[model samples]
Target chain A: MISKVLVRLKEDVLDPAGRALTEQLNHLGFNEVKSAMVGKYIELNMDTGDREKQKERVQEMCHRLLANSLIEDYEIIHEVIEKKP
Target chain B: MISKVLVRLKEDVLDPAGRALTEQLNHLGFNEVKSAMVGKYIELNMDTGDREKQKERVQEMCHRLLANSLIEDYEIIHEVIEKKP
Candidate 1:
């Protein structure tokens, strides 16, 4: 199985990193740009037959270590991919 | 317009972060797992009609700031999706 996450700042928050990138883009001569954001994606492959239970565990992992839930939100995806038999 | 980048450890390299994540998953009772990888993704929204020039600038931005080309790799994409008028 494979699991992936997309983590990003809340829409109402100010993202300094995102703003800096936009400014750099303008400086690089892409003034037609408006705004930008910086985020993270985590990909992992494992063997799983029970996605329901596995997803629950992964969500706990995200809450404890993989993400700072106070500032960022995440989406989880679990799929049966890449059979290693 | 938007640009995104995906950064991950090279396939041949060892990732302690990834290893740790797997161990934690197993410890948390997710024994049906094999391996894991941790990576980053950056996303931005900007206004643009000239995707060619915009993509060029975004690529440069990634090289100089958004990504460290020495170890990380990136991809560039451009599209005319919205009109601010």
Candidate 2:
């Protein structure tokens, strides 16, 4: 199974890195770039075949290690990429 | 329009950050985590409503500023989130 986790700062929170990039992009002539928000993308491959179990595990991973739930929000995109053979 | 760019280290390139995170997760008892890869997710909001033009502009942004095309691979997920209003 393959799970993708996207972690990003809440809308109310400020992101300096994203702001800096947006300014740089504007300076570089990407004037159409209205806004840029940066976030983390994590891909995890696991040996499990059960989809429910995979989701549960990924949720735990996100809550425990992957994201700071206080300031960041996470979305888990789960897919069963392979079938055990 | 919203364009999401996911930037990831090339497979041949070593990712120490990803390795460190993997180790930490393992230490935290996520033994089911076969592998973990870390990447960047960037969301860009533009004023245009034309999808093709949006894609072209985003491609340029990726090539010139958003990604190190040599060592990082980028995938652009474009979506027309709202009609210009």
Candidate 3:
């Protein structure tokens, strides 16, 4: 199974990196860009085939190691990848 | 318009940060995790309503600033966000 985790800052949190990118984009002539936010995309390849187990493990991973619960939110999606014969 | 851009390193490239995270996950008891890869997720809010122009601008942003064409690949998705009444 392949699990994708997207971790992003909460709506109320200030993202300085995102703010800088927005300014830079404007300076580079992308005046239509109103704002920007940067987040983390993590892909994990797991050896398990059980969907329920994969989801559980991924959620645990996010809670313990991937995201900061105080200011960040994470979403997880799972996909089953077939092995190449 | 809202544009989501995902930028990830080419599979041929080595990702030490991802490797370290994989190892950490294993140490933290996620032994089923075979490997991990880390990528960037950027969200941009644009003032335009034209999907084609938004896509073009996002592609330009990726090429000129968001992603390194030599070592990374980017995927873009556009969504129309409704304003509050």
Candidate 4:
């Protein structure tokens, strides 16, 4: 099983890096860009095949190490790969 | 208009950061985690509402700034938000 996690700052949190990117984009002539928010995308390959177990474990991973609950929010997407015979 | 860009290193490219993350996860008792890959997720808010133009501009942004063609690949997802009266 594979899990892809997207961890981003909360709406209320200030993102200086994002602001910098937005400004750089404008300077580069991408004037249509109003703003930019940068985040982390993590892909995990897990040994577990059980969907429920995978979800629970991934959620635990996020809560423990992947994201800071005080200012960041995360979403997990799971993908199951079939083993070839 | 909004565009979400996911930038990741190509499979052929080695990712030491991802390997270190996987090791850390294992050390932290996430024993089910076999491997990990880290990437960037960027959200862009654009002033233009035209979907086609938005796509083209975003692709240009990715090519020119967001992604490194030599080692990284990027995918863009666009969303259109209706303005409230």
Off by over 4 Å in 4: A82-85, B82-85
lDDT of 2 by residue, A31-82 (tens): 8888889999998878786889989988999999899998999988887665
For A1-85, candidate 4 gives per-residue lDDT tens digits of 9899989999999999999999999999999999999999899999996899999999999999999999999999898888899
Q: What DockQ was computed for model 1?
A: 0.57
For model 3, residues A1-85, the per-residue Cα lDDT tens digits are 8898989899899999999999999999999999999999899999987999889989999999999999999988788877799
Best first by TM-score, ranked: 3, 4, 2, 1
The sequence of per-residue lDDT tens digits that candidate 4 reaches over residues B1-85 is: 8899989889889999899999999999999999999999999999986889889999999999999999998888888787899
Q: What TM-score would each prediction reach against the true structure?
A: 0.70, 0.92, 0.94, 0.92
DockQ of each candidate, alpha-carbon based: 0.57, 0.85, 0.87, 0.86
The DockQ-based CAPRI class assigned to model 4 is high
Q: How far is candidate 1 from the true structure (C-alpha RMSD, Å)?
A: 3.7
Residue B40 accuracy (lDDT) in model 2: 98
| Model 2 ranges with Cα > 4 A deviation | A82-85, B83-85
lDDT digits (tens) for residues A1-85 of candidate 1:
6887768887877899889877877787767668877777787675656788678777877887678888898878676775478
* Candidate 4 displacement at residue A18 in angstroms: 0.6
| Interface RMSD for each of the candidates | 2.2, 0.9, 0.9, 0.9
Error of 4 at A55 (Å): 1.3
When sorted by DockQ, best at the front, the candidate numbers are 3, 4, 2, 1
Q: Which ten residues in a row have the lowest lDDT in candidate 2 chain B?
A: B76-85
